[model samples]
Target: MTEERGDVQELSDFELAVYEAVAEIDKAGGAADIGTLTAQIDRPEEEIWAALSHLVSANHLHSTADGYTLGPHDWAP
Candidate 1:
């Protein structure tokens, strides 16, 4: 499910920020939950939620009972 480079390029600034924040969570061995993301990134909960929703919709992130994580298509270039 690798995503095209064009798909990565199409992300908005906020979406990229959310994606980066999730990556950081992975690096830190933490869950990409709303609370953790809100703390790690300086955005409002509503904004984070919006970005998360968009990321999920775009198949850039996946949600699980543990939390959100990079989707199969979201491997770094």
Candidate 2:
């Protein structure tokens, strides 16, 4: 399954990883902080940050004071 939000036609593997990290955080009733994401996702912190940036820019993720979470967009498969 794929989603289109703003300029995003499809999600790259890295982006999907970042998104899944956030979803896992949500499931645990926690926030998607850099540290937590770093541990949850095998990728380097820089790559995670980059993917987060892309997801945010695409409006698929939003930043809160606590950390990152899904935006208005629905990414459910």
Candidate 3:
């Protein structure tokens, strides 16, 4: 399946991983911090951070100083 967002025709596996990581953290009642994500995602720290930025830009995820969260907009079809 594919996820459509602003300028994002499809999400890469890494990007989806970042999204799920954020969802997991959010479900745990904590912000999805980079430090925490670094431990959960099996990718380079830079790649994970980049994914986060991309997802947030695409409105596939949301973030604040506190950290990341799933987007409010419906993400799944």
Candidate 4:
């Protein structure tokens, strides 16, 4: 799917950071907690959680009993 931001066609700084964090989690083959994600983005827990929630809402992340990982469609390129 494609996202349109009116003038800009890509994610903003915050979104990019969040996406990067997610990608890193994918690269590491592990799950990251709110604390780790916050540290990575230098943001508060609430902020990171919000981003994660957005990802989840967008079907880019999956929240399991264990933790969060890339969703089924997230790996598609």
Q: Write the per-residue lDDT of candidate 2 for residues 1-77, one digit (tens) a residue.
A: 56555555478977987887897787677779898888877878889889988898888888889999876655462
Model 3: pairs clashing at backbone N, Cα or C within 3 Å: none
Error of 4 at 63 (Å): 1.2
Cα lDDT tens digits for candidate 4, 1-77:
65422221234677557866776786688776776677777777787787777777666667766567766542443
Tell me each candidate's TM-score: 0.79, 0.78, 0.78, 0.68
lDDT of model 4 at position 75: 40
In order of listing, the candidates' clash counts read 0, 0, 0, 0
**What do the candidate models score in CA lDDT, each in turn?**
0.81, 0.80, 0.80, 0.66
- Give the per-residue lDDT of model 3 (tens digit) for 1-74: 54556644578887877887898788777789888899887789999988988898888788888999877555
Descending-TM-score candidate ranking: 1, 3, 2, 4
> Which parts of model 1 are misplaced by more than 4 Å?
1-6, 74-77
Output the worst ten-in-a-row residue range by lDDT, candidate 2: 1-10
The 10-residue segment of model 3 with minimum total lDDT is 1-10
TM-score, cand. 1: 0.79
In terms of lDDT, the poorest run of 10 residues in model 4 is 2-11
